[model samples]
Target: MSDNPAADAVLNLVKQQHDVLEKMLNNVSQAGEAQRKAAMGSLERFLSAHEAAEEAYLEQATKNLENMQGWVEKLTELDYTSSDFVTRFGEFQKELINHTQTEIQHTIPKALRDMTQAQIDLVQSAFERVSETAEPVE
Candidate 1:
């Protein structure tokens, strides 16, 4: 946690989001075919919102997560029950883990150190707003 209270708050929020995304990813991995689609959908929607908020408020402070848009598109194309989908999804999971770990270990703290309290507060507000009001991806 940063010495700045606002930065600390933003860090906490981002960490919580990371935990939620990890849980969602696990749900997708463990889900049966009948349930995989819903789990994946939830993950994708939340990811979209999270990325949008980061782009709007945090991109300048941290290296944005590697774009996983292509992975999402590919996943959408493959039948969830197929072995190909399983392989690809596993790959996506690995990348997600790496990206989140990088943020937690490096990018987030570095960003917070550089930001003023007002900027940190803006990031926190945007994250909360986007999380609450983000529309579901079609």
Candidate 2:
């Protein structure tokens, strides 16, 4: 799990979206026209919700990362060779790598394997809520 709760929630939601997409694809492959149409409709809703939620989540995460990187740049401007500066930079780098690995390898796969139905439903609800209020793109 990430230290960031928002990131964890977003990741779980993304995993759920992928699962829904896969199921919809299977329905497309094996179901009759009526069933396929129903599945496609569900897919459209899920995709709209997923995209809105992911955009909001990622926008925040990117802003946070940018702020951190700006701090790192400030540190470099101060004294890149100082022991304290080097140590802080190393810590930041390590944290960035760990965060990446955890999201890619652990959190995502674990969400798929371990999330309960209720948890999945909660994420879906969150997505729907976001989608409902999001402004339409021109």
After superposing candidate 1 on the true structure, give the runs of residues whose Cα lies further than 4 Å from its correct spot. 60-63, 133-138
Write down the lDDT that model 2 would get. 0.49
Model 2 spans with C-alpha error above 4 angstroms? 59-138
| TM accuracy, model 1 | 0.87
Name the 10 consecutive residues with the lowest summed lDDT in model 1. Answer: 58-67
TM-score of 2: 0.39
For model 1, how does the per-residue alpha-carbon lDDT over 24-73 read when each residue is reduced to its tens digit? Answer: 88988999989899989899888888887777766642355545767788
Q: What is the alpha-carbon lDDT of model 1 when measured against the actual structure?
A: 0.79
Q: Which pairs of residues collide in candidate 2?
A: none
Candidate 2 local lDDT, 1-138, one digit each (tens): 655465466565555445554554455335554454444445445545554453443443343344444644554464433556445645654554454444446544455345555654565566657545433321
The CA lDDT of each predicted structure is 0.79, 0.49
Give the TM-scores of the predictions, in the order they appear: 0.87, 0.39
Model 1, residue 6: what's the lDDT?
Answer: 81
